[model samples]
Target: MKFKSLLAKPFAAYIYSKIQKEMMHAVADQEAILQNQIKTGCKTVFGRGHRLDDVHTYEEYKQAVPLRDYEQLKPYIEKIKQGKHNILWKGQPLYFAKTSGTTSGIKYIPISKDSVNNHIDTARNALLCYMAETGKHDFADGKMIFLSGSPTLERIGGIPTGRLSGIVNHHVPRYLRTNQLPSIETNCIEDWETKLDQIVAETIGQNMTLISGIPPWVQMYFDRLQAKGGKKIRELFPDFSVLVHGGVNFEPYRPSLMDSIGGAVDTIETYPASEGFIAFQDSREHEGLLLNTNSGIFFEFVPAEEVFDENPTRLSLKEVKTGVNYALILSSNAGLWAYNIGDTVKFVSTEPYRLVVTGRVKHFISAFGEHVIAEEVEQSLMSVAGAEGLRVTEFTVAPRIQVAEGLPHHEWFVEFEEAPQDLSSFSLQVDRQLRKRNIYYDDLLRGNILAPLKLRVVRKNGFIDYMKSVGKLGGQNKVPRLSNDRLIAEELMRFLQ
Candidate 1:
């Protein structure tokens, strides 16, 4: 074994033991985090405005701080941006993570000094856990590539600001810096295609062992590398062993990625966002991610169906049940209180609080009163595609309510690496799977309220071109799996094959 890999083993074991102990006491850890946040929050401007001083218990905290999304909390954030102290947290934020907003033009999410470690340390823990569980740490001996945003920052209200990934880039440890690929200048390139080409040039001849990125972008990199070298990724980089991916469901892209690699590689899934690092795949044998309960964040779950109600039912870590879909809410040391992050999850194991991300709260299709989530659509397509030995490149679903002759239906825009010989049959199989998963959709079909979903073949690189056109080609941006309206579908019509 290489010296670095040999050295990592003992440290990995120690970190793994610590993680296990935290999981065993997940509920107690959450309670302690909640109390600490409350005690600190009582001294802030937001706390004073919301009457947080009288709050001593969970119930009182809930009553004191109603759930708020980014827009709802913007006023306080604005105060902090204007250089106010003790407005949200104890002092001015250390940085602002700038992300493209859905409704708001640009969002500046605060990252406080106390909570910044949550982002950096949790990522390290994930890799160590992998090494400890699988006893495969040789990847550290060679180069590691993270296809991420530029490590560039600008000042906003005198606070450093950039994308979350870019901010994390600045904190990569000294040991790993020696093995990290793609020079800083190359990463600083703004355009994705330019940066990707540069990354390929830099790493094509290097001993790349580990790659981390969202699956779609990583797939794009693989395609480009193959085109340039005329060899499978594994042949070009024989040491390549681990793929760390998140941001979207990996199943739909797995077939294409594996084909490009030409062999099996260990993969680790993570649950991370601008707000916090929530979970990571802790064991190869487990079915779901182990929640990060001991981190500087306290989690809450509201039943998915009641999320839009005036007052939804919020359940704590100890109260969550397995198999129920719930919208994730959190209160963190970053000064976000009872904040709904807009993502939904389903707990698979309450014993250790392992959960699977189901979908986004706003990224669903329910125009016909049949709520179809991202997970259902992804599983439907993956099941049918796998059964037929086909590979999909990219896909999205949008409700088609204005049909010319037939009843309204869901329209699936898909780009295929290998097109099915019988498109109609493939579509039927996928539609059947979706119906089997969602009874509301099945009922709508039975009652003739909606027609069976229609499949539209998108030309190769169609999704990529669409994203590029909108200036969201890379760096944490992903196409919504499904939407209630036809905005994306209407735009996709130009790319139809």
Candidate 2:
């Protein structure tokens, strides 16, 4: 492949035309941003102003800057609230993408022109790579369908700042852009119901091809599409090329989604955040997604083992190798310098820098000191389901310590698409699998630890509906994979009880 790429370099250049130059320019621009951040970041820290010495290299960038979260920058954010550009940017931010405030309620993530440009470039690179591989720029001469969030623009006083989706949606090139299906860009409004109505109306008789969004939301969208009286959307739009999803793991909702789609529609995983579109699926056949290093940021990784309880062990772009788990860190033009985004990934390959996301370091349960990761839990559940031939609808795991004057145990509340005949055995199987994978669970089995695994079956789709009713639909609003305290667990227990 390397030899072919080298030999085909001249021809590739001829074929790509200015694309190669644009890619190179993108890299140069990203590097310049990193350089400038290292300098300004120091000035921002000291309030003494920045100099050349303060900037340069990862070490200097680290030393000259103090780590800050969104809360720390609240004063500047307040300025934006008052319609002023105070700290982060030279002017008022283009607009804010309304993201769920994980621990803080609802907060708006400020989006700048540079950050938006980076996201655009990432999308272009992904599209170009696909075009180069397939040799067919257009898929079956049909349009793509993106099941996205409310694309209504944020107008403080009705001036049209543009919807988060529309910001990029409107910028799609006139040449490549299609007129086939409804886009979230123009369709997103205040009401989700009205948006869904328009989406259904627009794609009812059209040749819609691609579908993209968070998995659970996509499943709900498919349900709506099917509910609109279609046996198969394939029958409606035969050319549908693929389903693209990201923001959260799709494993939990895969069964229902796959069943709704009838089969796999060439699934593509994307790792995009308000920070930037960081990585994406390289091809149809590959398991590992390609990292976009040449996008608007310089990538760094901290060994996953170092991600919890201590300061992280950082790695440069040149130091990352295969098979090791690392927490992702980024230094981008959008004022995030060496920012730890809390996502953990495993290196699948090094040459082109491909990785498989393992789980979030913070998103785990250690109630019985089992230290169960989200990936491990997902894999174990899938394995158990495959073994039992059971179809699951929705499920959630809560760390519980059964203290009834007895030893404590971890409990999982599951909702299956079909109820099993031997519920006890199925529950036992899930418990045993956890015991095998988690040392703490094993200790509990041996009467060493205080807790063992327990399972409770719930009505179908109960958990999902509850999450939705609470407005925890997508984009940072998720039923947590693990909840240490009983806050979420207690709330969920309302329906279970």
Candidate 3:
């Protein structure tokens, strides 16, 4: 009865149509966005050194700015941390978005005012797209349970720092904040477990119309809710209509999450990162997420095969074709210039440039040159899990490289809600699926170069225990699904022992 969408719906439809039209000319938009960014930042040190002072066109900008990763930009980032002005972008960053880093430790990504505002606006557009697509407006009348990070922003090198979700929470629209769950006091609870406990206590009886979070944490909340009510979630909250999810691929978690819901609910996936808001679900029936082309981020792609080459071909939006796996690189208003986000994706469409996240640049197994990606492994496991009626709680895979006695094989540490009756068959099915999916894996198996995939059933909540032990309990932290070496495997197994 509280249909507020009479006006909002038309506006959403118009905005979505406008966005679609703009995206058709995505390459042109990307070009202009980058040019403007260069001009605005030309006086900055990064811009000056990268020859942005003279670069006028996309081609010229590309030629001048060599593709670089986080390490190469660290020195400049350090200068910024010391309160330097105009280091990467104009003015000091409003804050730094801290994420996991390799080599030198935590990565501090600069979040300028422009970048933050764009993130806020892009997020709003995502909702508008959803409203235009679904026409489910009743949810707006009730509460929304958003299972994101604690909102207790802390300082990192003089600038406010926090997880992406925490930063986003601070900007939740005034109208929506009225229905948002987890009181501000409860949100500030540092421990994830304690925060969830408090959140459950606060909203267990409320009319939850929407739920949003990463699958694992959201799954935890659902489990606790079901435990409290001893009833199906649908019965507990009949008004719940949508589940917004992202931060990891939803395929592996979809079946289990659907089972938990006990009824139908619309789902929308987003590809928001600490560095930028990239893409979101716009089409109700589409397979891949629609790219946020006109958002304050310029994107480039390098073919996966040529990712490590001395001089890889960097393709603009217009040059990218459907189905080719490419390493996604971003030049954003956040001061990330042609920076690799370590994600690989494949375009599923060209006109509006919709794409699916394929895998991570670093989180893949290839010790034997089988070169298996997270997507392949996940797809294979999900297939087997589906056929055998399995619900995976968590899993991680690693190459069991050269033990004193055993042959080289991939090891899986899996935790499931419903344990398979025959673990051996489950393991065999996973191996067969992998071979079927990846030609290189099939070839390796055929040649007997690699032994069969090994599956080890971890104790219930073993991954939770492990993540906690490693000080990575919550807030956008997920264990890498596939590791190239036995280092993680050994450490994780040792932790179990």
Ranking by lDDT: 1, 3, 2
Clashes of each: 0, 2, 0
Tens-digit per-residue lDDT, 321-421, candidate 1: 99998999999888898989899999999878899999999999999789898999999999999888888999999988888998999999999987899
Whole-model lDDT, candidate 2? 0.64
- Scored by TM-score, the top model is 1
Better of 1 and 2 by TM-score: 1
TM-score of each candidate structure, all chains considered together: 0.99, 0.84, 0.96
Which lDDT values do the candidates have, in the order given? 0.92, 0.64, 0.85
Lowest lDDT 10-residue stretch of candidate 1 = 100-109
Better of 2 and 3 by lDDT: 3
Clashes of 1: 0
Q: List the residue pairs that clash in candidate 3.
A: none
Q: What is the lDDT of candidate 1?
A: 0.92
**Where does candidate 3 have its weakest 10-residue lDDT segment?**
488-497
RMSD of each: 0.9, 5.2, 1.6
